[model samples]
Target: MPKLPAELRGRGGPDALMAAVGRFSDLMTPLLGLTARGRRPAGPVDRSLQVVVTSVRAEADGVVSVRLADLAGRPLPGWQPGCHLDVHLPSGRVRQYSLCGDPRDRTAYRIAVRLIEDGGGGSREVHALAEGRRLTVSPPRNAFPLAVTARHVFVAGGIGITPILPMVQAAARRGADWHLLYLGRTAAALPFLDELAPHGDRVTVRTDDLGGPPSAALLPDVTGATVHACGPAPLIGLVRDAVRGRALSFHSERFTPAPVVGGRPFEVRLARQNVTVHVPAGRTALDAIRDAVPDVAYSCRQGFCGTCRVRVLGGEPDHRDNALTDDERRSEMMICVSRATGLDLTLDL
Candidate 1:
């Protein structure tokens, strides 16, 4: 992989943060000509790379901290905060994980994976992975990005903190005024608290009584800063409603899929394969595909992962994958949650 340019570093006594900003800004200079978020490359493009596990730290019952080093005797892509990597597991399952380390180094990348009891083995396999394990990963891809507003307010719930970790670190490095309200079931379940304690005056930890709901009082008065969040659906709903149209800004990332609105049954016709399957209400296209064709496979059943992507030949598809843009939505498809607007949908399958 090509190392990041050296000019990004500030001259003389300037800091790495400014250097990174300058480096990234130059990469995005082409984007400045446009106002809308274009689909074009924002910076030097990142690619999928393989990594070797150097260490693993089990945080709690299911949470595991991971450190990845490049296996090709080179550094991983230098990714901005909030960038994620696709991990190819030994079980032949691929999952996306957020990079939680500083982006300045072309060196190793770090991430924390939480094992989900109900999930399909990816997290459990990752947690059990020992040192020397080889993991194939995508170069950093950032679906969630920071804004240049005056300040920032960060909200993280449980394992959702993985993606937000670097953002907080970046905020501190920029001397940007920011605060983090970390809401989890307990401190034992949270990681990196020791490192975050110094941000004490700025960082707040919230734990609710089992079976009770968590309050968002820690989200202090906000007028200028942008609020960024990532967590479970319930926490997001609560925080989203609380900050509805308030002076506080809001943004979030979800590992879990968004709730899909139930609708009437629809017909899915595999265009090339000539297989027509009726996707009934309460059933997704993937489910229908699996029942009729078990050869097809996917990692995240949720819309969050793009492993189940297919081509949309005709009809409007309700795109639910985090992998696509509005333009891509009109073209390709995520068979996992997407449905057909027309009675007959044509999919590449």
Candidate 2:
């Protein structure tokens, strides 16, 4: 099968769409506006940092770690262990990747990319870049920060280790008791094993080939210990189930979008534009709205960033994002990852 054009890939972005329009002018003349909408040049940017790729090396099979530094070689913005960088691709696609390098290395930032053969083109574009390539990136923003605790239980599954690697180092630096449970399909496929090896018994690297899927038995006792997990949904779900009904706090970051419940198509009314668009079961409200008004604000369509937030005039919203507080959800919703709870929704737009 032919690969879909980058413009039509992922949740859709204005820049790539416009770039496509310029190339196939006659065929996509009607979609010229879509290109403008994807750019959203008038929209606000959360972070603006210019950096160049200093190095790119394979950490494991299909996993490449990239180091970015300022052109002037000055200190970039400071970031915590669990913070992530929003890389703006040359194709106008934006992706978020965790910073896995040493936090003390203020001169540059490091991130690892794992090629997802079936994913949107962002990872493939990043993996294709050679050294000396320049890109715009957002200063680090952390939704998953390491909390203060006497002990921490870090669970990382495959590429999810990107963020947890630093947390484990931070835990070690602070002399806090911490245990890392790393899981993968095989030992060679896991990145940063050499770096983690020095930790000795504190880190347990397991693979499906050796044992099996991470079971509740492998999970540590969470009593009085803060549990931080990042991985595929199943592993996070397993940890959540294991630590349920306990006083310990559980923090997790998911690479996938939230599952839609009651996936019936719904109608969305944009109050200011006086337009109503139908959001199909598998599509997001953001996509539907953008189809009508291309300039709608959004960043991190996964709902981590509140850029796409809008007032909910009427209708219950199926809140899927991890960013919003309980109070914020009462009136506002992130249109990117959220959807209408019923047959129709009225938005401030």
Candidate 3:
């Protein structure tokens, strides 16, 4: 942000200043107008932006739906389950929320947010805001994505339900076999149960005290199915243990910084540049590459968006990315969460 002279900040200053500003605006209008008229500039922004709030709905206790309009009244980049958007809230802070409602709605994105007790005023302000408050938001980005597998078992704990909701819906829509295990503290505490019950035998709902531990017995049947679990750390850890031998991918999003994963310093050779990045203890391969070499590009460093997918032209990848499938792991790798299993990793940078 640039600072303005206190005197020149607001007042419709001198007539000269007004004329100059108007002239600048008028001059740029034609350039934009030309592009708008379908005359593309050599370098033009390919993406279109539209600010619109088409509708609002109360889905659960604190969850609400705010419909956004895509450009030219068409759908924007459709997202899979576990996708989120960075919303510039009415409170002027950017908060990310997972898509919670139906995934088939091509016209708009349905996101649900729970009001937090001490969560930095963002969700609270959103709770109080009524329909029709326009806001700027980024395109959807996925942090947890569904893999292409023969079968799947989706597990969600409490509010962690947002991301998996869409995946199960997608599976159900496809008539593909899937089971959803949703656990919350209480029936009332679980917002979407009413909408979830119809899932019949395919859906399991459990609410119990921590001391009474939810059963992990259902996991052995988890064979031949991709196990997708999202929830609090403890629950996720438990699920991970239960699904030990299965081909599974675990993706977790921490609301806050978490202790680093334990790993040793490994060597990674970027074939193109002949650069070797050293993965330090507790550091990921992506971290090593960026810290040791700065020019590499990456985004959605969590490994779900495919933005950081790179080739392991040589050595085996100690795959940790949340999005890679058994097939994908054999090919591209996500440097963000993966580690080098061998002495040296040759990357196709």
Q: Rate the local accuracy (lDDT) of all candidates.
A: 0.78, 0.86, 0.70
Q: Report the C-alpha displacement of residue 167, candidate 3, in angstroms.
A: 0.4
Query: In candidate 2, what are the lDDT values of residues 1-349, reduced to their tens digit?
Result: 1233554455654456566556676455434433434443455444588899999999999999999999778899999989998888887767889999999999899999899887657789989988899999888999889987989999999999999999999999999999999999999899999999999999998899999878989977678899999998889888999988763799998776655555779999999999999999988898789889876766567788776899999999999888899999999999888887789999998
In candidate 3, position 109 carries an lDDT of: 73
Candidates ranked, most accurate by lDDT first:
2, 1, 3
Per-residue CA lDDT of model 1 for 134-160, tens digit only, reads 878876777788765668888898888
- Model 1 lDDT on a 0 to 1 scale: 0.78
Prediction 2 global C-alpha lDDT: 0.86
**Span of 10 residues, lowest total lDDT, candidate 3:** 1-10
Misplaced by over 4 Å in model 3 are 1-49, 70-72, 209-211, 218-220, 248-257, 260-349
TM-score of each: 0.76, 0.75, 0.59
- Report how far off residue 281 is in candidate 1 (Å): 3.7
**Best of the two (1, 3) by TM-score:** 1
| Position 305, candidate 3: lDDT | 48
